[model samples]
Target: MTAAIELHHVTKRFGRRTAVEDLTLTVPIGEVFGLLGHNGAGKSTAIGMMLGQVWPTAGQVRIHGWDVATQRTRALARVGAIFETPAFYEYLSGLRNLEIFSSYTAPVSQRRLAEVLDWVGLTGREHSAVRTYSHGMRARLALAQALLPHPDLLILDEPGEGLDPEGVHELRQMLQRLHRELGLTLLISSHQLGEMEQLCTRIAVLRQGRKVFEGPWDRVQWAEGPIRLEARPFERAVAGLQAVGLVLEAGRDAEGGWVRPAPGITPDQLARWIVEAGFDLLELRRPRQTLEQFYLSLMRPDPQSDSRSDSREVTRRPAAT
Candidate 1:
């Protein structure tokens, strides 16, 4: 099947500075794919390229088999997006704003408009002026507008921005239902790691415009590194592990120590070794890896490189309305 989205060696440069560097990615149909990166990590640029708002300096970007460069109108017809802060005509009523928006696209019925507004929890607020709406209300309005066309693919960049806890929870629940009932393909980019853990099934992390990790959430949670153990006779267990040539780092917490086992060492082997040494194993598991931890590890600058350079952030283009 053709991918819902594809970027092959996509590179974007602004004059002397490179914003996105030879990045490639794929998102399949009916999947919630996440794009994670630090500020100025080229996430916004990459997303802009996908949305056909910014032209790539090199390579190609495609949406559902349509090349965005050559078939932007066709590709975008099937896409709905809220990039960065959603902009709307503040003077107009929410209903009127949506009417103007839909006028530029395919004509939508009143019934359809009502359905979408209700879907986004903006039912009665449709007649109210946009300027009177709170941040959360405006966000819901933007979402309602995006769903007006019943897009097959929805792209949201920092959807949780400016949302309060309740607003965030509501947004999550709404999107979850939409994705489930409509089988919509969603591409979300955000800094909210915990929210991403709940929303995305698969994710890709980018650092300095290059992909550092890409896989299912479970694989990312169990990424390779160290296994932590809280076993009895801690001193003896540590000594035994060291005797076997496995490097162990003392755990920051009181539970146990973390072991970076030898190349051929498996968890099972370590368990046997612990048993043989007469240490009662209380807990033996890989250190739980959150999305935030995984992202930080990738973004960590090399000790050999100048640390000052890591603090410099690239400016991204304004988000498309």
Candidate 2:
């Protein structure tokens, strides 16, 4: 089956500065893919290229197997997007704004307008002037307009911006419903890592206009967090483990010591070794790495490189069970 979105060797340069470089990605149908980066990481630029609003300086972008640059019409026919801050005539009612925007593409029936408004939780507010709407409400209005097309693919740029905790939760639930019931392919870009952790099945991380990581979250090769060991006769336990060649680090509050086992040694092996050595094993805990930790590791500077450059692309493998 054709992918919902594809970018092969895509690059975008603005004069002397590159906004995106050598980006190659694929979003399969029905996947909730995420684009993640700090400001000026070229996320919006890449979204623009996909929307045919910005031409790529090199390579190609395709939507459902249709080239965006050459086959713009067909490529975007079934796509919807809320790129940047969604704009509308503030003086006009929300329903009027939707009607006008929808008219630019195709005629939308009143029933379809009502359906989308309700989907975004803006049903009653549709008749209110957009200027009277709060930021969160305005965002919902933008989403309602995007849904006017009943797009099979939805590309959202910071859809969570301006939303409070409740609003953000609602947005997440609505997007999930669209993908679940309508089978819409979603490409979301946001700074909300925790929210992304819950929403995206796969993600691509961009830095300095370059894609440094792209894969399922489970595939990210996270730095091994230290294992906390609590044992009786701490000094003997430390000496016994160290004598056996297990690398030990100082532990935090209440922990007897921390163990970073060698490549071949497992945590279970360490526990067994302690018991066999006649030391009482009180507790053994390994803290799992979160998505935030993984992202921070990627963004962390490489000690070997100059200050201007990012660390090397993350090496990925199936995470240990």
Candidate 3:
């Protein structure tokens, strides 16, 4: 099948600075492909160019094999967007905002409006003016609007930004349903790595205007296993991993060590191993590998140490003194 989205050597610049540089990516049809990156990493800029809002300074952007520059409307015809903070006439009811948005594409029917609201769990609240809706409710309305056209490709920018824990959970389930049932090609990005971990099938990491990593989400090198770890003296315990040759990129905490345990290695075993190696175990906790940890590990510099050389140097230092 043809890719849902493709970028070939795509570059974008604003005056003196390049927001996206030499980026090349291809997302397959019906795949929930994630563009992972910190702010200013060109994720939004790349998506904007695809939306025909900003033209790329260099290279090409295509949606469903239709170049955004040449086939602007045709390419966009298959697309739907939900901005970071969507604009709606607050005075209008939830259903009214979605109804107005629907007019941008096809002629709307009352049945279609009701169906979209129900799909997004806003069927009953469809009559409530948008101003009274919570962040999550607003998101549902935005989503309901996006779905009205039955878009072939959906690009959602931080769609879950303001949701509470339960709301976020609900959104995740809804997106999964959209992908599984609707067969919609999705390009969704969010700052919440944990949610992305559960939602996206593939991921791409962008850093400082460049694409650093891209591929299946499962293929990203996490530097450790699946579980998150919290241990007392997390830093020191992480340091101890060196003695045994087990590697982990642990985040430091005053209360303990936070680790994504090595696959096949339990948190307790890691803690016991740390203690056996001559360090007092304050704590060792295992948490899941979030999109945050996966992205962060890609950004961190590797730890390189030569124990033999260090010992020799230390021995020489004492002799010289």
Put down candidate 2 lDDT per residue, 1-321, tens digits, no spaces.
Answer: 999999999999999999998888888898999898889989999999999999999999999999999999899988888855789999999999999988776889999998888778788888888999988888888888888987999999999987899988988888888888998999999999888888887788888888877776554534354677888887778777888786554454553466676666678888889899898999876655566766765677757554233323344322232
Clashes of 1: 0
**Which candidate leads in TM-score?**
1
Candidate 3 lDDT score at position 173: 92
TM-score against truth, every candidate: 0.80, 0.78, 0.73
- Kindly list the per-residue Cα lDDT of model 3 for residues 84-190, writing each as its tens digit: 88889999988778778788777789998888888888878888888999888888888888899889889998888878899889988988998999899899888
Quote the positional error of residue 141 for candidate 3 in Å.
0.2
Error of 3 at 82 (Å): 1.3
| Model 1 misplaced regions, further than 4 Å | 229-254, 257-282, 303-321
TM-score of 3: 0.73
How many clashes does the backbone of model 3 have? 18
Report model 2's TM-score to 2 decimal places: 0.78
Q: Model 3 scores what on Cα lDDT? A: 0.76
Superior by TM-score: candidate 1 or candidate 3 = 1
Question: lDDT by residue for model 1 over 1-321, one digit each (tens)?
Answer: 999999998999999888888787889998999899889988999999998889999999999999999998888887888856899999999999998887666789999999989888788889999999999988988898888887999999999898999988998888898899999999999999989988998888777777766667676666556677777877678778888776444443454466667776778888888898799998777655677766665566757654323322221111111
* TM-score ranking, best first: 1, 2, 3
Per-candidate clash tally: 0, 0, 18
